[model samples]
Target: MKDQSNSNNDPIYYQEATTLAKLIRNKEISSVEVVQAHLDRIAEINPRINGVVTLMGEQALKSAALADKAVSSGEELGPLHGVPFSIKDAIDTAGVPTKRGSKIFEDFIPEKDATVVTRMKNAGAIPLMKTNIPEFSAHWESDNLVTGRSLNPWNPDRTPGGSSGGESAVIAAGLSPIGLGSDVAISLRGPAAFTGISALKATHGRVPYTGHFPQALSRFWHIGPMARTVRDVALGYSIINGADGIDGYGIFAKDAAPATFRIPGQKIRVGWVSDTAFGPVDPEITTAIKATAKLLADVGCDVAEVRLPFMENTDWLTPYFNLVYGELVPYMQQYTRGRESELHFIGKATMDYPLLNAAEYVKAEATIEKLRMHFAGYFQEYDVLLCPVNPMTATGHGLNEYIVDGKTVSAYHVMTATAPFNMTGLPALSVPVRLSSETLPINIQLVSRWFDEATILALGEKIQTGSEAYGKHPIN
Candidate 1:
């Protein structure tokens, strides 16, 4: 990460979305300037990274100009007014081609914005572009037949973890201040960690899922915001979270404002674990998690090293994969029936996933319930759970397996630290804490109870304040 604060040397594209909005509102800068700066950054850096698959420069500039006019007229402004944000291709955008990184839907343009997209625009945030993703967002790396692979901004030789890889790369490279992305397993948090940014996967149903592609596996799917700082992520999450009436799962979602730290004299109880039943973790990652726990404890929070019994004994991955692919494979087959030859390697692999039988499906459902109960019981004692975002740092391009702590493991092992929360539908935040020996980012995940995003977010802000990785962008 390098400093880009010299206005004459570099554009303000690296500033946080919250700061940009304030500058636009106070008349220190025009919305057009902020939007154009980001568009220019995308043009300059995207050629190497291939992160932005669809650029909305023309429309974004037009919208920015209109936003400036509204500001000049003394109109009331939203929190993110005129700030440019990127959207994952998996999420729909009106008048934009949301191909979901597949050739089958390559010509499809959404007629309406997804509920989360609409909420962002309603709050005056301009859509800058549609970032890349795996076909139907089924893989960890963000490569597809439609947009190819999204390389890491820190090192082009490595991957920006997917399926939100494109969004992560663009933001980490200072192409956009903030963005919207979805997660079923590691889509949001993994990419955020790989790219050295902040992302929050709010509790399931906290944000409506209407207008996203694939339209299956709604249970594990979550949509949230990604940015360079925790504050900007909080701002984006606040605006986009809430039910839209169209998503059945979101109907009963509770509305809670973002919480402030200190909690009125109560010490936040934090439980942390570097090693768990998930799988083998890299020693560097383990050290980072332990350091973060120490940081929280030093700051007056009641922190301790802890582990859950269910996580140690239960095989969550088998049930997660069986349940997800059981529904996802069939839903995706409809589009690839005759167009199978057009799919990328990841897409082809997704279609090859085994379908679950009746008994297995029932057992998977039972396991999911048990996981939820386990987390519920754990949360009764701790307010936040801190852990590693991934077992290793960003991997080389096209890697299907990785060596973690000298042990070879499948690439899906990256999801071990993340997908459990997706299954439990708990709110989770990924905050970049340090850079590895190779200068790659290492992040820690902060998870809170269901519908209790405020706790994790408030705690994330504390961790981010001392984070060396926050507010820093890749030079390339």
Candidate 2:
């Protein structure tokens, strides 16, 4: 509806959230100008990617006006003051229809904000719209009966990675600077890698998970920040990290202010792996990860190869699916009580699956603790673990198979490198390094000890300093 182009043709639409906030705070640009520029970009490009299914232009402009007034009133603003952000459809936004890319909840609107959303608003970030996701967010691609599908901005024929795919798509397409997304089994990390963006799957309970729907698998599910830069993730994490008194899983740090937000000065220990128990990683992806590790090592980091026995010879699906059906099936039944036919395909499949017994669930929980302890010992020798976020890059839409180094693997195999951290409830970050041979985005995963998101962020920042992945947009 408006022309948002700059005179020199530099794409202001793709500027990072922190840059936009600084401009607004310094009066170099108005909040309305920044929000309107992004709204214009979304209107222009979202049709191709289908990243943003809902439009909140009017509401965003109103909020931007209020932010400008606050700046004019000489009030001290939060870190993200006057920045525009999007919310994954799975996360609740007060008065917004959080349809979750499904038909059953197509008409549903939340009366209150999610804890993460509340904190973002408190930090002066305005919600521009709701991004798309899979039906009930159960798949690796963001498509459903409601918003249809979200395509990768890098290549429309491919997916942007699922659940949080739409958020990553919009950010890569310059429609939004940053966004909020949830990860249960590689949802955020996978999409972030696929779309060439930076995302953090914060340690469990680091960010409160209150006010989200389908509270099944709450133990491992996490809501976190997806941005163009790793520093933005650290800033958003600080604002949203804390107990809200509603989420039973939320925790308070022992320190007055967590040091994870601060940059460390000493040389850090790092470990890397191209593949886990999952064999046959793409050669190009391995090269990208090795390049990233070498960059960190060049900057005075003690980088080496590290292996954990807990990650070998084991199928991640066994425990992950067991926990999913054991915990999520009941919640699915509660929602689809009498309307089985109304359920999405994945939801119906989940409901039809044979749930694990109480003993099996107990065993599954015990196995999770075992893997956690093994990784804990592994981290004792290294401050962070670097690995491939996915065995390959983004894949074609509506497809279920992938060719990873001449081996045909199912879609679930893409989660092999990521779901382990989800099972352990450890902090993991996905940082883009370079483009694959196919010209698709390739990213490296960074894992830290439980509740130690700071180390990963610090290390990601170091690599980012010498990398070309940051702010490289798909649509100029």
The CA lDDT of each predicted structure is 0.87, 0.83
The regions of model 1 sitting more than 4 angstroms off are 1-10, 253-265
Q: How far out, in Å, is residue 410 in model 2?
A: 2.0
Predicted structure 1: lDDT: 0.87
Q: How many backbone clashes does candidate 2 have?
A: 0
- Tens digits of per-residue lDDT, candidate 2, 1-476, equal 12222122446676777778888999989999999999889888988999987889999999999999999999999888889999999999889899977778989999999999999999999999899998888888888878888999889999998889999999878898889999998898999999988899988887889977668888889999998778777787888888888889887652323223224675678888876655569998888888888898888888887766667777766777788778787877767788777766766776787887789889887877787788877866777888888888899877678888999988788899888898888899999877776678888899987777877898887776567565456776
- Give the Å shift of residue 184 in candidate 2: 0.5
Please give the TM-score that candidate 2 achieves against the real structure.
0.94
Writing each residue's lDDT as its tens digit, candidate 1 over 1-476 gives: 46444132455887788888998999999999998888778778899899988999999999999999999999999999999999999998988999889888889998999998999999999999999998889888888877788999899999998989999999989899899999999999999999889999998888888988778989789999999888889999888888788988876444754333335678988999866755588888898888899999988889999987688756688898999999999988777898888888888888999888899899999988898898888887888899888889999988778999889988888899899999988889999888899999999999987777887888788888787765556873
Task: TM-score each candidate.
Answer: 0.96, 0.94
Question: Cα deviation of 11 in candidate 2 (Å)?
Answer: 2.2
Winning model by lDDT: 1
Model 1 residue 180 CA deviation in Å: 0.4
